[model samples]
Target: MTEPTTHRTEVVVVGGGQAGLATSWHLVRDGVDHVVLEAHTLGHEWADTRWDNFTLVTPNWHCRLPGYEYDGPDPDGFMTRDEVVAWLAGYAPTFGPPVREHTRVTSLTERAEGGFRVEATGPDGPEVWEAGSVVVATGGYHVPIVPSWAPALDPSITQLHSADYRNAAQLPEGGVLVVGSGQSGAQIAEDLHLEGRTVHLALGDAPRVARFHRGRDCMTWLAEMGLYDTGVAQYPGGLAAREKTNHYVTGRDGGRDIDLRAFAAEGMRLYGMLEGGAGTELTFLPTLTAALDGADDVYRSICRDIDRYIDAQGIEAPPAAPYTAVWEPDTDPTSLDLAAAGISTVVWAIGYRPDYRWVGAGVFDGTGRPTHSRGVTALPGLYFLGLPWLHTWGSGRFLGIAADAEHVTGVITGRKGGARTEPAADLARRRSPGEIASDVALAG
Candidate 1:
């Protein structure tokens, strides 16, 4: 027999990661009744990620929630995957938000009246809960998408995606081929090489970052200068500037001391890598120019702000580092073919895209991402936080999530408008049993 549907508070938060947890924390602080539904144990998904030496590109200070600081030794240092997961697990209980672990939300349907009915399955069985709103904090990085060409690769050679890669232990003894030149790919190549694996890094036109300190930690400076807030909504130009600068870091003050050139110098081989679908061959010249052009305004602003701060403090600003490499792609045919030489395992670190099939219909754009004003969806009370480039360039990044969450919270509590709601009963009737069952099965 089908179990009776359960009714809960006004808001239901799906996913218990940093995004979801932060949303719940804010909801509770505002006295907004909410329940957080986690499909797996808190931080369990990270436990299964393959990269062993994974560290957030963004620093720790930015890794904060509404009321809590991410207290750790190295505020400027990036946290390891374990540290991040542990931090999230610890942060979840402090707010005491009701978190239903292992509860998988299969389908979310909007009630015509105004609310939502969330169909889920847990250890018990099929369960349904009604909420005035739903917040999909299930981040864009959960699923690892390897191209179809991966399986077609010669099975004899060892190949693994960055998601399934843990450490050098998993790589073949001969050499490693890290596909995709994003941060993850570079880091993995470095890690494997350090572990004594001959590493070949497939080079695409990747973004570059300057490794220097501007003033305080880069994140602290960003917060102080209001970069995160500036990129939100009203400031579309600032948002665009932020997005472009994020493509590659400008060499200036104290920042990370790692970059692609540094990685190459450390003995990581570079080869040509491109999106299998994009016919355009990877080149450094135009890509670098694009990156530099995009980041120029943001970097200048950061420098100007630093100067102002230094002047205010009556402290002499240090000399800037000599800018060395311009943004450029390697178009050398020889460099592109290095993979065929001896590279074995290829780690795809090309970044993540949102997968929103569970969100049902009428809410997403052609790209499968939720369509919202700030965080409020067309389906009333349904909200989203921590989506990549949601409104601005920084929306998906660590510092940006907080801003997005705050805006989302504001929208949900009636402090803001542009939201629609669905009645619980009407939402339930909209979903087919098959769709609900499929979602539940995946969550399980």
Candidate 2:
């Protein structure tokens, strides 16, 4: 027997994180009917994050949702992973939006009548929902990228990605090995070391930001100088540059800073990029900036903006010290055999990319990222929000998503949830040369 299909609301929001909740908040404010579908319990993914010491790098002041402020002890203080999860869970109830928990959206496609068909699986079995609009807020950081060589390591040595890591208790008694030098990697390395685990961090070409300067968060400096405020039109090359710089810094609340070079001074080993083969030695460069010159132009522009802002404000804030800290990869190329170093565990924290297999054609570029002006996708009534580096440098970050969500909501409601015609020149300019070439080749 065929189960009857169900229909409700004007829009459907996938994922229940900060982004999804924020979208729902906007929809309610606009008096638009919408339902949020979460695969697990509210904030379950964040609650299940492996890092015990994980906290928002951005302070509380900037972490507001659409209608609710992040009202906690320290407005400028960093929030732990638990605190973040709890806050997101509280948002929907406070705003009176219906968020359906444990509902996993299996697939989404356009309906025959020009709406959306969302197929989902829940405790009640397979269900089909029809809506006029869809918001793909599934988030960008859900999946972990484990290198293929990772499985070659001996099974006896416990290996887990940063996402699966919780506390030092989950690791073996001997010690631990942390791979990737991104923000998560660096923070976890410091946490394990503080927990009394003899830590060895595998360094990559990731950049670093100072924890604080002149008694203010580095992010505040970036915002005050209008660095994060620039849009793609004003700075076409800015997004690519920000991706390379790795400007995130770990906070003191998470753990004491374990400088990659200073790790060796504290009797911890630092290894650079790992070559393939059974026992390849790790190599290092003096500093990562040589590989990061492409990003320096953007940083210089930001610094210039800061200088101009200071002069215009006539504020007597003391200038920050000259940036002398050299964040370099490990130079001593010794093969610290995992078995020999008593390292029984490994954690990979490289980064994340979107997987849009379920999304049909015409909505995404070759990269699988949705094609959108701000949050509106290419297809009519299909929109996306809360993607990493979606528009600005901080667009997908905690502090930046709310503005994007509000803007998207305004577009949806103002036009009665219909697609807007793109100006020909604007459309042509948005496509990259490579994309145009691909289209031409396909036509030929």
Candidate 3:
């Protein structure tokens, strides 16, 4: 019998998403021999998981993936889900990322003698890889979560996690109940509302941010304000802030504020956080008003920050009025009768969590979170990247990938601490027409 093949490399970067690719970008510059292993094709999540009408909440400019910043026709504009996949797909070929597509890393264990062993199953079947260093860039969003009572709902009512949801037409012809008001929940709810379908939202305590504030995008303003540069150590809530639900906002239809109150005024129903459910009935808390008000508080706070910045900088900006609630719930409904309301679908956008047991128990804390400073774990040469606050606010996002990747690569390359931007001079390098044409044939 043929033995499972074993290959050796300097580094093994698991996950071929933007995070891994970003790491690969730096490794290539430093001339490191590393391979990125991905369970599926690169950017498959954006192509498969996101709703059909999905677009970026952050504008195109924030897609600064190490070498490839968004230089497409739309810099300020939000790219559609397909465009995002294309942009990511285009990235690997330009720099020729040594990525093994369709390769699933089953386990990563440390060798007793100063290296790591990676076991994976590829198209050629099972194989093992040995590397001096291992970077887990798979990120923290692995398992999609729904409430415990989801399975008990009536079989007639279609239930889909935000990860599995594609479009409104895919569901049964009836009203939709979107549980959770985070980015995905809010955007998906808006998508359904635009389709003229009845959307009953179960709002969570996640804050909302202004899409376009004053003369620029809120992200743009925040970036200038050094919000993205704030590291985990300096973050207000410290490490505790990492688990916070992201502020919900949208960039759909050229970008605008997501006001659940406005949505409510337009006939969409709003409920509080989901508590439990049985059959066709779902129970919620009496925090609908609190959630909306909390969201607005964040929105106004962000706008005020932008306003202060504009005033401080003595920059002229457009005038805007204070946001007032467009509508309010006459009664905070603690229960939603799906069958009675004609709701045939429940889109749960609660959130996701990663299971890191496969990486072994030594590196994780009691809470199952990686115990690392920046991306470096207690175990030598075993590191994590692309997780929220891995280094800074930008660490989990495109805006910070380069710096984080550079920092991690610098350590692997024996340069020690600090990220360098000098390598980015090679970022704008273009691919030949033939090279670009032959790379990554994707489907709509």
Best by lDDT: 3
Query: Which segments of model 3 are wrong by more than 4 Å?
Result: 416-419, 422-444
**Residue-wise C-alpha lDDT for candidate 1, range 341-394, written one tens digit per residue:** 565555667666677777765888766767777677877677887676665545
lDDT of 2 by residue, 141-220 (tens): 65687877766777777878888888889778887878787778878887787787898876677655544443344555
**Alpha-carbon runs more than 4 Å astray in model 1:** 1-5, 214-216, 232-255, 275-315, 325-331, 334-340, 391-394, 415-444
Q: On residues 358-443, what C-alpha lDDT tens digit does candidate 3 reach at each position? A: 88639887767898888988788998998988877777888788888888788788876545553221321223433222221110
Residue 107, candidate 2: C-alpha displacement in angstroms = 1.0
What's the CA error at residue 349 for candidate 3, in Å? Answer: 0.5
**Residue 262 accuracy (lDDT) in model 3:** 90
What candidate 2 gets wrong by more than 4 Å, as runs, is 1-4, 236-245, 254-258, 277-308, 323-334, 415-444
TM-score of each: 0.77, 0.84, 0.93
RMSD per model, one decimal: 12.1, 10.7, 6.3
Best candidate (score: TM-score): 3
Q: Per-prediction count of colliding residue pairs? A: 27, 2, 0
lDDT of each: 0.62, 0.67, 0.83
